[model samples]
Target: MARSTLLEVMGRHVQANHDTALQCWDGQNKEYIPVSYSLLSQRAFYFGERLVNTTKADQIQGQVIMIACHSPYATLVAFYGAISVGAIPMIFPMPLSLGSHEALTERIKHWGFAFGTPAMLVLEEGLNEKFHSEIPQDIEVIRLSDDPAASTETRSKSANDHQPKSDDIAFFQTTSSSTGDHKAVSISHSNIISNITGIRLAVDMADDERMASWLPLFHDMGLVGAVLFSFCNNYSLFITTPTQFVKRPSLWLKTMHEQQCTIATAPNFGFDYCSRLISEKDRDAMDLSHVKHLFIGAEPIRVSTIQSFLNKFSSCGIDAQVIRPAYGLAESTIITSISSHKKPSDFICVEADSIAIGESIRIVDTLAFSDADLSRYDPSKSVAVCTAGKAIDDMRIDIVDEDGNKIDAPGITGEIAIQGGSVAMGYVWGGEQLVEEFPDQYVRTGDIGVIHNDELYILERIKNIVIRNGENYLVSALEEQLAELLGISHEHIAVFESDIHDPSSDIVVLVERHAPIDEDQINQLLVAMPKEAFPINQILLSRAREIPRTTSGKKRHFYCRKLYQSGDMKFQQAIEVSPQRIMQAQALVNES
Candidate 1:
């Protein structure tokens, strides 16, 4: 029989056994604590019983139950508990830093009213206290305790009396808010199962495959790709928090080594951070030869970053072929396309000027091109794009022009559109289902990309394009060029148009500075920019971590631009080219 809903999958795993389902890292003890499938099921049922006894059945039957727990175990229990009761569960990250207390309270209140959220589950005492004191009485606040004894006494009718159908909503995922405000994407149980099935087949998942992840539970890649996928497939997983990984990158590797995990996933930044921060001593103590797949996605995949990571970790038994650059969005239930494990990621060099909408890209094939060849390409004239691989099973990808007509020619840049079983039903906001974003079962991804050799290649978000003087430039490409010229990580740089509507508006460049760079260096950087294609207009330098970023470490270019325009971003130094200099550059372009 085919499994339709998440509850069905959970039911299969509920049989009492000593087999480990999850190995949660204890950061304080520096060891992994195992959680069995039967124990997890029991705790989830107990939590569901408590929820059913306290809240009205009508309130939870199909409404949203918000979860903001820090622990992965607690969060999963809360998540499954909500599902057991037929309520939609939404996981959100708890506030990591001590910011404004009132602001946090207001934000919680806003979500409560907006989603008509009946209850909130939290584990942290400080968060529990804040909610009780400030949150409205209408919104019930439930504090989950980690103590085992607290849940042992519970035995009541399980909330499984009403079962959900395959098309029923499984959960809600929020956009990263990189381009705009956060919106909730409603994914169905069938959507999840279909995506999981596709990913399993695409990666050739095995019965003995063990997984490890440090990504937060709130993110789609962590929730769907790591947690739910493993749970549904009965794969053993090792889990930890993002904070732990950031504090000690070695923990992730050590856990992987000890557990002999075969699969792991992270954004491109994770590999870069590990390569840069992990000590040589720690690297020598670990072996990654057993790691079969390292799925990289959720942000732009930099070839340079991947090569650097491979070179740094090759001594630790890491293979260059394990790096899999993927492309996905929240609307697709986590994965759309992933590079195949059969070969290393493919790359191509293209003339930058030929990347305009509805135009065929001119491939620079005169040289034997590879990811390492990025340094050879002229930053302003060419770009090296990596393949995100073919669409997964039953998923169809098409590159469409502005008119929504499909672009038939390969290598022509257009908006990427998807049609697949995993496509989300629609978006929700303030407890109301918004109008359908996808019509005719096709989703316009709002991402710009191309098709080359029958494989998908991501370029940039439609919103990330900067138009000046009737020419368009990819902001990410420009940022990479600037980073290379300045000898810094591209992750620390942001480039966008100051006034998107004004063709002659200044091109704003924001750099997050880690070390001091003198004025002369900055001036040289400005002068070194390609005079014809790029005119150095304004540069702003802020302290490290000042630039706005999503939780997944992607630069929020639109948000940063708004901050710059409003004079809210705190910058240590600001440099602007005079109008005469700008005119001179423009004249130079005219002469060319």
Candidate 2:
């Protein structure tokens, strides 16, 4: 019989596998420390035993247990431990260099309240003092440790007696608020297990597959795709924190090279960062020939970024087919669709002007260009959108109109809706919105996408669209064009409307300045932009890291718009372009 719950899966894996381990990178030592499955299971059981002894099983059962830890090992233990004793675990992001401490505290408080004040907060030992006073007094706090004694304790009977049903919520995944406020997505045990099974089949999982990841544990991609996927499959996983990867992008590649990891995952920015920061010498020393699949998701997939990454690492035996463009969200328990491993990624070039709501996109071309060729590609005329491939097993994807009616014809732009076993039960907080969004067992993804060649191609979130003068402009596409024109990373720029509800509102652009640029140079760059496509009224150059971002490195466009409206955004330089200035800039471009 098949396993019904996550606890059963964990028990079966531990009983069958003893050698497979979870390895964590030690940045200081520059090496990975391995923890065997046997030891990990023992520690988890011991932690669960402690929890059950302290609180009644009925009281903790179905209660939220929030985990905030820098160490993947601690997080894994705490996460499984909570589930072992029938508690629902939720991972929270720790403080990062780019994020503020006050912001994190406020977020934790807000989420805690939203989660009905979690029964407990599990934190890393080092962060106890920092977060102790900030946390509510009623919620018990537990500090994680790596004590060997934890593994020596006998498994508690009470912990083993409390088993969660398959339909019971196993964990709560917090959505990355790139467009709006965060909501807790309640994922059941069967939901995640079904997704894992789908992913395994989609990728054609092999017994020898080794995984490496540096994604944060709080994000759904990291928690479900990397950590739990590896654990449930009994695959050897080499893990590290996002801080380590950002500090040295080479380390992620180096670990993959050293371990001969076959499967890896990262966002679009990660691939971009690696391509830009990894030195030539490091690239020469790396051998990624063993890599079978490099899943890229969590943000908009840029064809240029992937092409540049492939070009930079081609000499290291990395094949172009290894790159897989994927699409997923917290609502789907991480993955809804992923590119097939048999062929190279597919992309479609469409006329930018033709992309709008409830309309069929005009196809410009169908091809995947190389990095050298893409450098000459004009973003003003067209945009190349990558296909996220077919839906996974037992999952159905459809394009729906604004009225929630299904659209049959392909290439028509509409909201993407997913119906599958992997879909979460509902949001913990937003019940009313959940009722509207989740209808007929299908979660209406706020993303705007289209069905082409029996595959899903995401364009942009509906919330990210800015309308002016009866024209809709995709913020992400505009950001990409502006970044290319200004010769900067798109991650450093954020473009959004001053008021999404007001069509006449000013279009504001915030660029994080990495180096000093004179006002004339900025003007020249602005002049080069396609005025008919995107007309900027306000531009601000802020200090590095001034623009707010979610923990997953996604720009909080809605939050940034709020900041701009409140006049709270800090900037070193500001430029307000009048209608006369735009006319003059257009005239200069025409004359040149």
Residues 42-150, model 2: lDDT tens digits: 7787778777666523566766777877888889888888898887788876666214455456556665555443557787877747657888766677778643333
Candidate 1 local lDDT, residue 158: 54
What range of 10 consecutive residues in model 2 has the weakest lDDT sum? 430-439
Q: Write the per-residue lDDT of candidate 1 for residues 110-164, one digit (tens) a residue.
A: 5566754454544444455645587777776777764333456543325656588
> Where is model 2 more than 4 Å wrong at Cα?
1-3, 56-58, 115-118, 146-160, 177-182, 369-372, 430-439, 464-592
Over all chains combined, what TM-score does candidate 1 have?
0.77
Candidate 1 residues lying further than 4 Å off, grouped into runs, are: 1-3, 16-18, 97-106, 115-123, 126-132, 147-150, 153-157, 177-182, 365-371, 434-437, 464-592
Q: Which residue pairs collide, candidate 1?
A: none
* Per-candidate clashes, comma-separated: 0, 0
Residue 341 CA displacement from its true place in model 2, Å: 1.6
Global lDDT of each model?
A: 0.72, 0.75
Q: What is the Å distance of residue 64 in model 1 from its true position? A: 0.8
In candidate 2, the residue pairs with backbone N, CA or C atoms under 3 Å apart (3 or more residues apart, or in different chains) clash, namely none
